[model samples]
Target: MYKLYVRPGACSKAINVLLRDLDQKVEVIDARNLEGFKSISPTGAVPAMIDEQGNVFVEGVAIILHLLEKHNSAMLPKELLKKTDFIRWLTFANATMHPAYSRLFFLNSVVKDEAEKANTMKAAAAKVSEYWQIVEDKLNKQRYMGGDQINIVDVWLAVYAGWNAYFPVEVTIGPKAKAMIADVQAMPSFKAATESEKF
Candidate 1:
């Protein structure tokens, strides 16, 4: 009974996957038309959600956490070290990885000149590569970002990895990362949300 505002291939995919994984029924509104969302969330972001009780939720991390805590799901563990590690990857993906990709995707919006846009894109690609190196290293160590399970962090990770396709930056998922992506994709709900959006 949640209404999710989403545009195909946005980080809204994070909430899509979460809802699917939780087997929760939700109303998905295309964010290309934000009339429903703007009234709730000022930013009118795609990942915004309207809960069953009519309260609104926004942002990838906040929404993901809301579903986890509200549903008492194990995607985010209750332990100390695992929770910290889970939060570490989630923050790294959102705070660090997302910015570089957003810049690369919107380089033209920021830089007016064609020449400057090209230079800026190259610089943005480099930053994304640097961030990917960090991610690749971490995935090389574990089966999933949030620990052994393919949780919200893992779903968002797959979402971003696929989203990188929109930019010139290419992120080659390591073996373990590939496994996680494959696992998520294998889900009927995940495939329904993502298969058409793949680049």
Candidate 2:
């Protein structure tokens, strides 16, 4: 069995949803305690996992890809080029969109000066809009990032998109992004994972 360390509504939620969707047996370790997580991973982020073989893993993108590959799940496309695209989109979401929103929403906590907060928020919002527009363009052509089928890229993007419900970042994907996220939320896997959360 795999052991997942997570906090509710964080990126780790995607892994939790995937594990359930694939019907994989895994143990969840809620890392609400910052100290505990720091001891496990110096970066102190949630969604880290330990395989039954006692190998530790960190980062949401890496964890998602690892699980999909290890389990031989159909969550990813089989074609080499399409699979590369899937990984590209996943990394883009993680490295670009995710951090942009994080900066916008947590400006007070992350940035010290009140004068700099507004500027930071504005920059963050602009970056988020730019990244989301790419998603909008791709989604306009395909049902999912991996063409007609839902895959790991969709899961990663959905994990962040769900935050629009509560987080302060303004990601204007117009009506299409909203609809796409609604579609993802309606999936049995997404609903099950979200409903399981205490938040």
Candidate 3:
């Protein structure tokens, strides 16, 4: 059996959405249980997955790649340039977009002053806006990240985009991205995994 560990409202939620879409069974550990999460995730990071053989997988990008490829899903893409673009956007989402909100939302933990925290989030908002526009441009050009069909990167983008409302940042998506998000959310599995979580 596969054991999935994720903090509520974390990127791991998207992984579970994909897991359900792939028709895989998983035992999810709640974020509220600190001991359970710490024991499984040595790094104390969310979204850790353990396979039946006890192999622990960390990081959303890695988990998505492993599951998507294992299922032989075209979400990964086969075309040479599209494959490269797929990896590029995946890394961009993880490295560039995700962390800005991490800092923006957690500013209170690091900064004591309310004014300072507000300023920090304000600064982070600009950075996030840049990343959002990059995605908007891409979506405007292609139906999905690499092509006309929904892929793993589309899942990543939609998940992050869904969380935009929770932060103070202003994220404006084009018609294409709006439609793409609708398509991803329309999936039964995606709705099942994400609709309940508070990001």
Go through the candidates in order and give the C-alpha RMSD of each one to the true structure.
2.6, 2.4, 2.5
- Give stretches of model 1 more than 4 Å off: 109-112, 169-176, 195-199
Q: How many Å off is the CA of 64 in candidate 3?
A: 1.6
* Candidate 2 per-residue lDDT over residues 46-148, each given as its tens digit: 7798888899998888888888888888867689987888788888878887887786668746777766776776677777788888988988887777776
Candidate No. with top TM-score: 1
User: In model 1, where is the ten-residue run with the lowest total lDDT?
Assistant: 165-174
Which scores greater on lDDT, model 1 or model 3?
3
- Which portions of model 3 show Cα errors greater than 4 Å? 195-199
Ten residues in a row with the worst lDDT in model 3?
190-199
- Candidate 2: global Cα-lDDT? 0.77
Deviation in Å, model 2, residue 137 alpha carbon: 0.7
